[model samples]
Target: MTQAFDIIIVGAGMVGAALATGLGQQGIRVGLIDKAVPADFDAHASPDIRVSALSAGSERYLQSLGAWPALVAMRATPYRRLAVWDETPHPLSRLLPGSLTEVEFNAAQLGADHLGHIVENSVTQNALWQTAQAQPDVTLMTGQGLTSLEQSPDCARVTLEDGTELSAQLIVGADGAMSQVRTLAGIGVTRDQYQQQAMVISVRYLGPPEDITWQGFFPSGPRAFLPLHGAGDQHPDETWGSLVWYDSPARLAELKALSDAQLMAEIGKSFPDRLPHLTHIDAKASFPIARQHAKHYFLNRVVLAGDAAHTINPLAGQGVNLGFQDAQCLQGLLKEARRSGDDLANPRWLGQYEQQRRPANRRMMLAMDLFYHLFSNQIPPVHLARNLGLGAARALPFARNRVARYAMGLDEQLPGPVQQILHRLPGLNRI
Candidate 1:
C-alpha cells in the first residue's frame, strides 16, 4: 500500500511524539511511527531512570503545543533550587566554597519561578502520545520499523519493514540515537562514549517531596538527585522521588550486584551532603553513556528531530530539552513556510533547519564533552580550578545569571521571556 501525508515522523519517542503533537495542532496531517512502545516494565517503567531538566524555553514550546499541562498533570517535579559542587566536596557545606558559591547555574538569579521540571521520560512521551490521540490529523503506527527511504528533488518515498510505503513532502527521522530513518536518509553520526555510567534509582525519601534539584561532580562523572511529585495526598502511603548517580561502568556493575539493603547504604554514601536522603524501594539500573550527533539535521525531503538528530551526554540532563528545541524550530519554520506559499519540501528550507540547529547542538555537545573530560580527572589542580571557577561564577551575579539562562535552555531556545532574560547577561555577550 502506498499512502502519503503532509508529514511523516519515523520515531514516536518524546521528540518525535512532540513534533507530531505540535504539527497536528497546526492542522498538519502527520504520520508518526515507532518501532515499539514501552512494554510496561514496572522495573523499568521509565526507560533509563534519568529524568530531563527541561529548560523553561523548551517548556514554553511544549506549552504552546499544548503538551505542558498534560506533563504537569501527570507526575512531573518542579525545581526551584539548583546546587552543584565537586564530588570530593562534602554535601554538608550547604555552601559553595564561599556562601552560595557553586557551579555555573543558579535558579534564583535566573529570574524565573523555577529553573524547570524533572520529568520521567515515560510520562513525557506518554502525555505526548495521549495528545496525539486527540488530534484527528495525526496517524500513529507502532511495532513497525523503517526499511528504506528514496528521495528526489520534489518528494520522498519511505518504505516500512512491513513493505508499506509512504510518500510525503517531508519524512522526519525522530527514531533515536540509533535511528534507522537517519541511516535510511544516509546521514552519519560523529560519536563519543563517556567512560562513566549512570545508576538511576527511584526511592522513597523520609522528608516531604522537596522542590530542589542538585548534583555533585565526581571523577567518574556527576550524580544528580531530582525530586519527583508524590503519588498524591489521598494515597499517603506511596512514596516519591528519584536520584541518578553517575559513576564508572565497572563501579556501577559492582553496585548493581549488591542486595537492595546494600545498595541503599551505598547510595547514602555516594551522594554529596546537599542532597536529601531517600530509601531505595526499587532496584537500581545502570546506563552506559555516550554522545551522538547527526551529521545533518535535514537532507532533501528528510529531516531529523530529538534523539534521532542529536543525543547529548545526560550529565546535565539536556538530551530531551535539546530535542524539544529541534521540534519547535522545525514546526515554526515549516508553519511559516506553508503560510508564505513556499514549498515545504524545499531543500532551502530544510537547509535552514540544519544550519540553525546543527551549530547550536554541536556547541552543546562540545560543552558536555569538555565538562566530562575536565572534571572526570583526579588531577588536584584541575579540581581546585574547577571549584574556584564555580565559586567565582557564583560571586559574579551577572555571570551566574548568564549561566542560569543557558542551563534553562532559555537562551538558546525560545523568543520571549527566556530571550529577554538572556539579553541582560553581559557574560553571554561574547558567545
Candidate 2:
C-alpha cells in the first residue's frame, strides 16, 4: 500500500507526539506511529514503568499543542522549590582549615516560581494521543514498526512491518535510545555508558505533601524526593511526588528483593547523615538507566529527536526537557524553511539543525558526567574540591543566576513570551 503525509514521525512518545500535534496545528499532515499503546492503568508502575519531568518550556509548548490540559488532571504535580546538595564525605583537611563543606541550591533563586511539573509518562502520552486523534490531518498508527526505508532526491519511501508503504518529505525519529529510523537513515551515535544505573521507584509518602523538591548526591548517585499529593500542612492524605532513587544495578537488585518494611529500613542507611523522610516511604518499582546520543540529529530527510538524539543522566531530570528543546527547534526550523520557500528535506537545512543541537546536547552530557564523577569521588582532594565548588556556587549570586537561568531554559536568547515571563519572575531575587 502506498500513502503519503507531510511528515512521518517514527516514534509517538512525548517529544514525537508533541511535534505531531504542533505541526498538525500549522495545517501539516502527519503520520505518528508507535510500537505500543499506553497502558490502561498508571503508566509508571514497577518493572516496566514510565515517567518524565516536564520543564516550563516543554509544558508551554505542550499547552500550545493542546496536550497539557489532559495530563494536569492526572498525576501532574507542581513544585515551587528545589534543594540540592552533594553528599561526598568532607576530608579532615577542610574541617581543620575552617572551610565550608556543603553546597546547596534553592530553586527560588532561579527565574521561575516553580521549576516545572512532574507527570506520569502515560498521563502525558495519553493526553497527546487523545488530542491528536481528533485532527483530520494527523493519522495515528499504533504498533506499526518500520520495515525498510529508501531515499531519493526528493523524499524518503518508508515501509511498515505490516506491509504498508508511504512517502513523506520528512521522516522524524522520535524513537527511544535504540532508534531504528536513525539506523535506517545511516545515522551514527556518539555514546558512553555510565558506570551506575538509576533504579527509579514510585513511593507512597508517609508524611506531608511537600511543595519543595529535594536531592542529595551520594558516593553512589543521587537520592531525589519529588512531592506528590499527600498529607501536608494544608491537606491530609495529600499524596505528592515520586522518589527517584539512584543506585548500582547489583545493589538495586538486592534492595528490590527485600520486604516493604525491610527495604525501607535498608533505604534509611543512605541518608542517616541527612534527610530520611523519603527513604522511609514504600517503593513502587525500579529500572536501569543509560546515556545515549546520536552523532547528529538530522541526516537528509530523516531527523532524530528526543531520546533518539540524546539521553543524559537523570540525576537532575533534564532528559525530557532537552527533548522538548529539540522538538521546538525542529518545528521552528521547518516552519521557517517553508516560509522561505526552501525544501524541508534539503541537506543544507538538515545540517544547520545538527549544528545547532549537537553542541548543546554535548554540553549537557559532559555536565552530568562531571557532576556524577566529582561529587561521588571519595578521594580527599576531589572531595575538598567539591566542597569548595559548592561553597563558591552558594556565595556567587551572578554565577548562580546564570546557572539557574540555563536550567530554567531562559538564556540570553530565549524564544517566546512564555520563556520571558519565566526568566523575569521576581522570585529569582533569591539568588
lDDT of 2 by residue, 49-142 (tens): 4566677778888888787777786557787766555566655434432222333444577656777776767777788887777678899999
Per-model clash counts, in order, read 2, 12
Predicted candidate 1 versus true structure: per-residue lDDT over 1-431, tens digit per residue: 78988899988888999899888988888999888865432432433365677778778877887778887876677788776555544443344444223454446776768878888787788778888868999999888887788887777888888899988889988888888888887888877776677888877676677777777677667888778766445435544677787877788889888888988788778777666656545646777677777777887788999888887778777788888888888998888878877878777778888888887776666555444433344544333334435333333333333443444464653323323333342222322
- Residue 53's lDDT within candidate 1 is 76
TM-score quality measure for candidate 2: 0.83
In lDDT terms, how accurate is model 2? 0.68
Q: Which stretches of candidate 2 lie over 4 Å from their true place?
A: 40-49, 92-111, 231-240, 272-285, 380-431
| Pairs that collide, model 1 | 91-273, 91-274
Q: In candidate 2, what residue range of length 10 has the lowest lDDT sum?
A: 422-431
- Candidate 1's displacement at residue 366, Å, is 2.5
